[model samples]
Target: MESPDHPLAAQCLQTLPKIELHRHLEGSLRISTLRQIARQHNLPFPSNADLPALVQIQAGEPLTFANFLSKFQPLRQFYQSPQIITRVVEEVIADAAADQVRHLELRFTPAALARAQGFPLNEVMDWVIESARRAASQRGLSLALIASFNRHEPLELARQVTALSADRAGSGIDGLDLAGNEAEFSALPFAGLLREAKQSGLRLTIHAGEWGGAANVREAIQDLNADRIGHGVRVLEDSSATALARERQITFEVCVTSNVQSGVCPSVLAHPIRGMLAAGLNATFNTDDPSISNIDLTHEYRLAVQELQLTLAQLKDRVLAAARASFLPPAKRQTLCDSLEIELAQQIST
Candidate 1:
């Protein structure tokens, strides 16, 4: 059993003001909340005790993409109503605040949230935005939303999501993210749509180089015009891709445990985050699917120090790097970076 009190390292990591740029709302649902929803809605699933095994990765389970993706199947049943959607969004923000994440760009798939109950896409987006705003205001956390499109899904669906996101960009939606199976489905078909999304005043972050290869990262930068690359840990596999990333100063949102759990890396220690950092790539730590992976940004930071052998100073720099790499507009991004610098300096001095 875990101790009641956090260890010194955990405590230290929790105190740092963090930024999470690659978190998915669908994957961040609390197990406790899921259980409550399951019981209240009478969904077809096991009892509360057995629910975690379905939605969360287990210790002995095969850590493959198929196994990891299977968890979300059971999750879709829980988004049964607008009220449930709003509640989950509020809880996600509350959980992030509790984890000491000062700024968060939460990405959500409209298709996943809407498909379960056949809710209209616009209404779903509205509920998420409203709930996020309420939660952020209540907890004093800076929050933003990113609309995510799946590669395996139809292009027409992608087009619809892009249109909705672009229409709502000024309200609270900050960016567009390409997320889904990168191994079988190619990102090529949606390149024009993503480029148009960028031109429509929405920022872009492509999920590439995890299930795919380093060349996908190059395509994301050159073709899709992504402002950032999600899980581009494989960029080091190609020297040219690494050089291009460096030249473009593209930020790589590195989710260490997610990669290991998804079979992208052999183990936590074998993760290329260290190599990405050493190669002068602007790499930042994130918890891609916090609840699904049973982690938070604090856990990722601690893992960086313990497993990846990152010094406290180096970890601090990466925290700042995440702030700088945020999808916020220029002035707001700078303000966030400056505020974090002051708080981080104070923490280090103490």
Candidate 2:
């Protein structure tokens, strides 16, 4: 539904390679797939459930945070079986591949998946790990999985998720993410635990400065030891936070439209991504939840050019910055950057 055809969008941005660092698995479920699975499995649902409206932000819908989160309410029911999980994972990776994302660091909630069927937490992790591996391999897109934990959930459960990610660091999972309601829950409770996950070699990315304030960004940088900040557009509110982020050179995985649609920002044109970059913060564009927000990375790129006033060359720099900021290890990250650099150059020339 994010089909844009602005006149200035003459450049083949979709053909250009991209790097996505903040996409969510639960929020990426296709409505058609959800309906199909629900029908095939005969899952219980309200007889009057408007499946599409429940899972997709409808046109003219209130762009409030409540309305944005309402989409996930129905999505929680569809993860009934291992095959269902695999199919969704494969489909998400395939969707990214079709968008020409050269490298994607997708974060999924193990607890969310497990809670659906009373599935064992570790078992749910296994399904996603293996599914993403096989799917990424089949699609020929470089993919990394980040085990995500909800901040509103119990701390012990977060510890379990972190332990699971740390246990399988290089094998399947590459990073650990702190996601969910930042407006209501404080990330301070999980600080020491996340720091240990980082020390154990799992990359750390915290969702802060979106629903929360600039101080939260300061805490995420100083306390959580984040390698990247997810939707950190609000980091520019306080000079100290901006200065700290700049000094640390923290990568901000910015998703522009998601922030607008989620009521974090009033609108795309008023988004603070440009301010984040101008303040010397390491900022890169991303799609937080393409399916839920009715968008893709291409829509994000086009939005950056058309609304955010970012030129194509500046967008190219952000793409390479994202590759450098990826969760891959030093040598492998270099290889990915090398390959992407070549592909980008070839595309630019032709």
Candidate 3:
């Protein structure tokens, strides 16, 4: 149905250097890779299941956040060992590099993996950090880790994970994030943990207002002092909150298809990304769960440019914004910025 020369499709696939600020590590694994890993582990996978149908579940009419979250648990079997985690990290980096993503901020909940594998939380953190270093070296892409806490988990446990994540400032695990179903629990419950995390010099990025409301986004910034928001698409509903986002230059990580698949937004056209940009809010596109959504950063960029009709120049700026919001060091940030400019110029000249 679509061809390379198709005007809109061509514009969407422009090979611009990209930066992914809000990618879930577990969610980014390639579905084929997921199957391979399951095979390697001798884990049960349905033989006659609808592969394409299951992979593109998000592309269906619409799905609730609960329905979307259900897909993640089926792949939990592969996340048991540090070796597997390390391998997944390497594969994730390779996928990003293949997508031409120059920078990535990956989020994961260490507690879940630790509990699954009978490993301590700190040990899991150590393995992820080490594995990330190896992956970065191979791809030459900057990567940062954001340790997450399941919202439904005990508040004290979340606080502990936050403390542990912040304890290793210059080493790895750059920040703390509160993730999982936003509507299932209150962000207020973790306010104390977030405050302590900020005090320890670690940055904060929270998953708010995706399935929740603008109030959740408001509280994440006001209460948790979140540096950036993960999928705060609902912020447009509250004029005051949206204005504050613009005033503070708070970044909102927009995952287009993911929102539709997760029922956070109704349709691709109904997405509020353009509205947020029009309101002067800082927003950038990302693939929240590349594996689950069956897409990648380049695909998302294409969707924004083609289906969403964002100009190439605007997409260029969005890539730059993603790099700026990422947790990379200043020197690395400049390198990414320079790479983006070079790629943009090349695309134009071609």
Candidate 4:
């Protein structure tokens, strides 16, 4: 695919040090790596050309929730062993470094990784934690892992994952996230588990108000106690929810391209990021599924400026917001926020 014609904006955005708070390891795999894995594992695929159409959103395809989700069905086949999982984790960190993401909180579904080969959940978690630490140290990026549980899954599995995440809180895994089919499954079932996780010192983030309505956002904040929201762009639909978010200072991780591709919004220009900002809601830009959406952090920043008409100052503020909203401990989080403020000030002046 050809690059978009935004030379100066893209250059400036690419050069700015950024933070990513919402990225999925399952959706961040490279197509080339997928092809190589397919050939090595002898998966049933006719040719390399057919891989992108199956794993990525195409131009001519329908941009519905089902089509966007169908891409992951084939991806589940690739996590067949331990080595492949580690390789994918390393590559994800490298990609973030290439995009100038100074800090990243990459979330992954353990069930998705373990169900393919019937690997033990605790073993999969161990591999991800060790692999992520090694990769982050080598890449010189501040990285943290969040174990995600699907709301549609059973409560027992959520409990197991939450217990594991809490047990490894300071070691590697720092947060717990509720993700999956918000349009169909309600987040109410796992509210008690999330609260307990929070009490156990694990931060919380819930996927709400994207496929569902603003009430889901309210429940996430008021009941589930989400420190940050994954895609709460639809919070504007209800005045009460908007006011509640503003009152509590909850951060929203807004992904522009993902919303458009998943039919959450009509188009990129129609995203409610600007509205969220106007309402005094803390908002940050992120790439929910960079590879699947065919974008990077820089691309999303450029889109915010050129398409959504966000000024450079506003974009800089959003970057800082993400840094502050990270799931790191108090001392580490402040250090990161302070360093980013200094760096972003330098970038804004030039």
Candidate 5:
């Protein structure tokens, strides 16, 4: 089980100046805001007292993928308008800023957003992009939007999202990610589009090996050419798979809490991030879905130290590693690395 949150300790750990690379915009929606939207749209959701259980993983729930995936179903109903879409993006960013998350790469599926209201794909992308551009600026946060495609969706939908991402690369979109239903779907269907995304100058990240196995991790690296692997804790299941990732030096955006909640890991204590590090693999801590798991980056940092037995020094190393692995271009990436180095130097074993 995870430990109780220490608010003050979290304040100090905030000096990682926190860089988060794997958070999902959809999964990051505010529960209270969801309630407001529910009332406004007359969406048939549970009353306020019971809403969290519907959209969030409750204690003692079966920690299985199907149970975890079901949480998003109620959420899908709330994106009923463009104002609602933009409001969610802005609030998610604002929440990140409040957490002292200085650098965040928020990945969102346009198809999911568009599907809810029958909004056009490009319109959904623009709503997110424009809102993110404005929100990050107002908050003085370094935020990037990753237009993610669900692997289970039609390959044509993926292509349309990729093309839109490529067209708006520099403006607000900085990366593309393949997310969703990794258990049943293969990344192969969207491989060519991902490769084309890379050529179009959009960085690639693929969700693999969390619900599936380590072979998916290998596939993400070799086939999809992922710049980073999302929740690749299962990569240790296969030695050759582990070796391939180590050789490529692929960054694994390891989400400690989400893995436990989703049953990817048996529990937080059993997360393989430390083992991944020992094997010379590059790993970074991230909140896969802060709202869904009822956790923030601070909660994850606390776990990294107290439960995972990571020294604050090692925690700092992971933050820098995430910064180095960010999809930002050479100049901005170096600047982020430089700034994090200065801030992380302020913390010590506590």
Candidate 6:
């Protein structure tokens, strides 16, 4: 569905290696796969369940936050089982491969579904890690996992999740995060947990300035000392927060479609993606809830083109920013960057 004749889209479509720095494993499931899982598990599927179907484009506008968040409930049902979760992880990787993604860091709150399924947190993380390992081997794309603590949960549970990430430091876990409804929780109480994860050598990223304001992003950076932000688009509202992020070179995972869908920004054109880049802030595109939003890596890239009108070099730079923020080791990071340069050269040659 991308236009190769369009320079930006052509550049994005030419198998140039990319890194998806922010994505949720459960949110990226294939729609067809969702239906198949429902059928396989003998659950009644939703009437609006077809992934390939064109969602009714809201007349004259896009989805509001409440409306957009509503679609996730049915999608959440598919994530309740270990088998389903593993399948989603694998399928998400394969989906990213379609757009030539070379590396990705998938984040999710394992505790939400683990508690729902009566399973322990570590067990759920193991299944996800195993799935990621196998998917990487098969797809030839590096992958990393960031465990998110749902802010809606009690602060004690947040501490426990971060501790679990600390305990599994040697394994596949790469980082700790705080997410889910920034409006409902404060960042002050989670400092100790984030500190523990950092002490254990895991990185920290948090969802901020999405539903909340620029002050939340400030608190996340100053109080929580986050390495990256999940959706800090609102930082553009405050000169100080924006300056601080640029000064610190804190990467913001910008999900354009997700922002419009969640009503964080009124339209894709209103997204702070290009503004963030122009302001010297590190910005990367991602598919926050691919299934619910009915989008993929290619679609997100296309929005950056058709809506934001970024140049090929800009898109490449965005991908590079993602690679830099990726949870891969230093050696692998260099390997990926070198490989990307080579591939881009090859594409331009032909």
Global lDDT of each candidate: 0.90, 0.87, 0.81, 0.92, 0.88, 0.78
- Local lDDT at 129 for model 3: 91
Write candidate 1's Cα lDDT for 160-200 as tens digits.
99999999877878999998888888898998898788788
Give model 6's TM-score versus the native structure.
0.91
Instruction: Give the per-residue lDDT digits (tens) of candidate 4, residues 185-280.
Output: 999999889988988888999999999999999999999989999999899999999999999999999999999999999998889999999999
**Local error of candidate 6 at 36, Å?**
2.4
Q: List the residue pairs that clash in candidate 1.
A: none
How close to the true structure is residue 7 of candidate 6, measured as C-alpha lDDT?
70
Q: On a 0 to 100 scale, what is the lDDT of residue 121 in model 1?
A: 97
lDDT of each residue in 1-350, candidate 2, tens digit only: 11134443445687889899999999898777887887888987644367766777788888888889888887888889989988899999999999999999999999888778999988888999898888889989998899999899899999998888889988888999998899899999999889889888899999999889999899998988898999888888899999999999999999988888888899888998888888888999998988998899998998888788887777778999999999998998999999999988775542
Q: Model 3, which residues run further than 4 Å from truth?
A: 1-14, 48-62
Which of the numbered candidates is closest to the native, going by highest lDDT? 4
Compared with the true structure, what per-residue lDDT tens digits does model 5 show for residues 50-118?
999999999889998889889988888888999999999999999999888889999998878888779
lDDT of 3 by residue, 1-350 (tens): 23433775465464567888888886776667666766787766765344434444644434877677777776666686788888888889898888887888888878766775678888898888999888887898888888988787888789778878878876897778888768878888888888888787778888988988999999888878899999999998999899888888999988998998888888898999999999999999999888888888888887887778777777778887887787777787787778777877666432
lDDT of 4 at 139: 91
Residue pairs whose backbone atoms clash in candidate 2: none
Off by over 4 Å in 6: 1-14, 47-62, 348-350
Better of 3 and 4 by TM-score: 4
User: Weakest 10 consecutive residues, lDDT, candidate 1?
Assistant: 1-10
Clash pairs for candidate 3: none
What lDDT is reached at residue 306 by model 3? 72
Query: RMSD for each model, in Å, please?
Result: 2.9, 2.9, 2.9, 2.6, 2.6, 3.1
Candidate 3, run of 10 with poorest lDDT? 47-56
TM-score of 3: 0.92
Model 5 — which ten-residue stretch has the worst lDDT? 1-10
Candidate 4: residue pairs that collide: none
Model 5 score (lDDT):
0.88
